[model samples]
Target: MGNKTALYDKHQEMGAKLVDFGGWDMPIHYGSQVDEHHKVRQEAGMFDVSHMTVVDVTGTDAKEYLRYLLANDVAKLQQKGKAMYSGMLNEDAGVIDDLIVYLMTEPGVAGEWFRVVVNCATREKDLRWMSDQTASFDDVALTEQPDLAMVAVQGPKALELAKQSVSESRATLIDQLSVFQGLESEGWFIARTGYTGEDGLEIMLPEDEVADFWQALADAGVSPCGLGARDTLRLEAGMNLYGADMDETVSPLAANMGWTIAWEPQERIFIGREALQAKKEAGISEKLVGLVMESRGVLRAHQKVVVSGVGEGEITSGTFSPTLGCAIAMARVPSATADQAEVDIRGKLVPVRVIRPSFVRNGKKVFD
Candidate 1:
């Protein structure tokens, strides 16, 4: 048995195939992963993402502390409810974890506050790092919201179907929410952010009420999806999965996450800024790029990527793209690798085309 979310019984009742993911017993699929994946891409689907870790930071120094903790600048969030994605790094500039932090309080307020959602597998280490970084900031405090549950409703019709499950006031707010923005109302944090490369909302509400909400969405005809579909959807969207794409030993520059770092305000320093700056000065040798194979074969992680004359690399995450009808991957390769590469599959070298990391967006192929 593994740690179960508040909706464990609900998932079982829906005939979901449950699997252990990072110590949590999660639904891998209800009946068909391919079907579920198509549902999210072509129509609407909901995923029980309650196992994700949610933490709230509040106090006199919350903003300053965050600005000092994350690689991306939270100071850039000039309005309340705005969210930004960032990587929390160690002293060596290696990615400790990647997360989305929302500015919960009005900008420039004395009571600085923010909400951060992190990967559940890195809960202990991320929390410890966050706490230790706050040692110098006497006014900051961390509160974990273990009592909350999350659900992600995604696809083109996701917003309409999800709105049918919430209160009228919330529905109105959900309609008004802009992409990458999150707001709190009636004890719920509804954000228009998702991992599936579709228009969606990730709502965090009380655990006690989440089961009913999930059922309500089901009654409204929203498909209940699981982790298997979630993985393919995110991978197709070119989003990086922690532990697979990068970790404590990999630099953000090599993870296709360099855009997430904030380099300005040279005087204001974050935890790993110095090391990252040093890396920048020394030069970046490797980069993460996309791989596309137009054959009838599936791609899997850890496959060797041989860039002829350049060097060897490995696929961090790979999957048969449901939206593109081809195998797509994200691989870490030598900085000079370009245009073409090959993946070793069962001792056979299969040629692949390398392009920008993104493969699909809004159910459309993004690469040329």
Candidate 2:
């Protein structure tokens, strides 16, 4: 038996195929994964994301502590409700975990508060690292919100559906929030952010209320999707998978996550900044890129990628793209490679065209 989310029973009730994901028994799909994928891209879908860890960092030194912990500058988020995406790094400049931090404001709460959301698989390690860092700092506190159950309502109708599901007080606050901003009401926190490439709200409510909320969304015509569709949807959006696209072994730059790194505010150097600076100056040898199998056969992870006249690399994340009607993959290859590459599929080298990313968006194909 594995750890289960608060919505575990709800998933089983919907006839979901349960799979073990990072020690958690999660739903892979309810019926057809392909259909679920289509539902999100074209209409509406909801996912139980309670497995993700949400932590609140408080006290006077909260902002300063996070500035030293994350690679991106937390100072940029000066306004209340502002959010920033950054990566926590190890001493070696490798990515520890990618996360989102929101600057919050409560009705009588003075000083600044931060809410951080981290990957479910790396929650323990992340919490440990955070604890170690905060032990020496006075007036800083970290509290894990285990009582919260997160649900992501996504697609073209996501916002509209969310307005109907959330409490009136939270609905108004969330309605005023921009992308990446979040609002907290009673025990529920609603964030206008999501992993899926669509307009959506990630609502965090009491675990006890999860089942009723999911059912309400279903009754409102939002399809209940599972991890299978979430994976395909995020892949099509050019988003990186934690363990696949990056881990403790790879730096953000090498994984095509350079945009997430904050290079300015040179005086505010965080962990791995020196190493990242050195890499930037030395010039990158290999880089992450997108590949589409030109021939027939699905691409998969760890497949050998041989670039003609360049060099070799490996596919980090790959899948049979439902929208593209073909195989698409994200691979780290020699930076010298220009137009094409080949992937080793079953002892046979299959040609693949190298493109940028964002293969699918808004229910349509964006790239070949």
Candidate 3:
């Protein structure tokens, strides 16, 4: 048995197929995974994301500490509630984890605060690493918010239906939240963020309040989704999974994360700055790219990718895209790889076309 979230009983009541994910008992699906996926794309769906770790960094030195901690400059976040996606890297330029950090207060102001949300699978290691990095900063403090529960309400109608579930005041606040921004109301943090590549809100509230709120959203016609659908949705959206897409052994340059690294203010030294500079100077050997199967076969992780005369690579994350009606994948291949390749499925070589990593966004095909 693994740890259970606040909605464990509710999931059981809904007949969710439970599976152990990163030592936590999580719902894989309620009944049909495909239906849940379609529900989110066509209408609205809610997911229990309480298993993710949320840590609040506050104090006088919060900004300075984070500037040194994340590859992306938090100094760029001049407005409160603004968010930036960043990769926390190691000294070797290897990706420790990719996370979203929201500036809770205006930059350069006293008592500036930042909120970081990391993946559940790397929770323990990430916390330990973060603590070690911040040990030298006496004025910085890290507080883990285990008492909070997070739910992501996503899709076209997600925001509208979600507004009906929250307080009237919060609904107004939600209406004002811009993309990649967040606001707090009535002790709940509502962020205009999601993993499904759709417009939605990720709400974090008191653990005790989540069940009722989730139930309210369901009653309001939002479908209850599970991790199984979440995976497919994110894949279609071209979002990277923590472990499957990249890990401690991979550098951001090779992981389709180079854009997240802030290079300006060149004097500001963050972790892995030296290694990343060296990698940049030496030229990256491999790059992460998108693959679409032209032949009739499913693409999956660990499948060998043959880039003709270039070199071999492997699929990092692949799936039968429900929205695209075909197989799509993200793979790490030689930087010289062209627009065509072949994937080794079982013993047979299947033809695939290489393109930009994104397949679909906002229910439309993004790549040709």
Candidate 4:
């Protein structure tokens, strides 16, 4: 048996097909992945993201330390309850992990603090790295929130459904939350964020209470989705997967995550900044591109990508997009010939059209 989240029993009751994902027994699907994908796009659905790791950083130097540790500038988040997405990089500017850090409105005494959520697969490595980086700092204390479980409610009506599951006092906070904002109330840490290309919320509550909260949302008509739908949904939304899209050997610029890097504030310095800046100045030879298959075949990872007259590339993440009704992929292709590449489907090399990602957003198709 693998590790189980707080909603393990609930998932079993719902007839979910559970699979081991990064040591955690997670639901791959309930019944139909395509139907679940469409549900999140058209109505509302919830995902058990409890396998993710939550860490809290507190101290006088928390913000200062983070500013130097993360590739993105934490100074950009000035308001309380605000969150920022950033990448932690190695000395080579290669991505270690992409995470969301929340600037808590109130610290322990009710002022404010910083909290981060990292990918489950990189939990141990992330903790060790974070600890090592902050070890020299006298003012910071990093603590993991192992007592919590995360549930992401997504879709057009996701916010409404999530708000209904919370108490009146906590529910009011949702009304004032801006995008990329979060807050802590009672034992719940609710954030106005999601991977689906729809406005929604991700709530972290006490592990024991997770099933109850999920039941409440389900009673309100929110479908419980699984990892299969989550992957396709996030891919369609142009989000990157840590392992599939990027790893320690892949830099942000090469993974189409250059936007997450902040090069401003000439006075501030962060780890891997020099390497990244140098890479930018030298120009990246390969880049992540989006692909739409013109033929009848599903794109899979590691598929060969051949440019008509150029070089080659490889599909990093691919799937049959339920929303687009076709196969879509994110590939790492030679920058010299990435515009229009061909994918090897079956034994034949099929032509594929390349475009910037974000294939679907706000329940609308963004790509042709």
Find the candidate with the highest lDDT and give its number: 1
Candidate 4 per-residue C-alpha lDDT over 114-227 given as tens digits, one digit per residue, 9 for 90 to 100: 899999999999999999999767788899998899999999999888888889977898888898888878878888998988889999999999999999999999999999
Candidate 4: give the clashing pairs: 105-112, 106-111, 106-112, 107-112
Q: Model 1: runs farther than 4 Å from truth?
A: none
Candidate 3, residues 34-147, lDDT tens digits: the string is 899999999999999999999999988888899999999999997779989999999999999999999987667777899999999999999999999888787988999999
Tens-place lDDT digits, model 1, residues 1-368: 99999999999999999999889999999999999999999989999999999999999999899999999999999878999999999999999999999999889887869999999999999999999998999899999999899999999889999999999999999988989999988889999999999999999999999999999999988999999999999998899999999999999999999999999888888989999999999999999999999887987899999999999999999999888889999999999998999999999999999998898899888889
Question: What lDDT score is found at residue 293 in candidate 4?
Answer: 83
Candidate 4 lands at a TM-score of 0.97
TM-score of each: 0.99, 0.96, 0.99, 0.97
Q: Is candidate 3 or candidate 4 better by TM-score?
A: 3
In the range 1-368, model 2's lDDT, one tens digit per residue, is: 99888899999999999999888999999999999988898888999999999999999888889888899887888667778889999888898899999888742247778999999999999999989888767889999998899999989888887778767887688679898878778878888888878878888899999899999899888999999999989888888889999999998988888998888887886888898988889998888888887567899999999988888999999999887788999999988988798999989988999888567877787774
- Each prediction's whole-model lDDT (CA): 0.94, 0.87, 0.93, 0.90
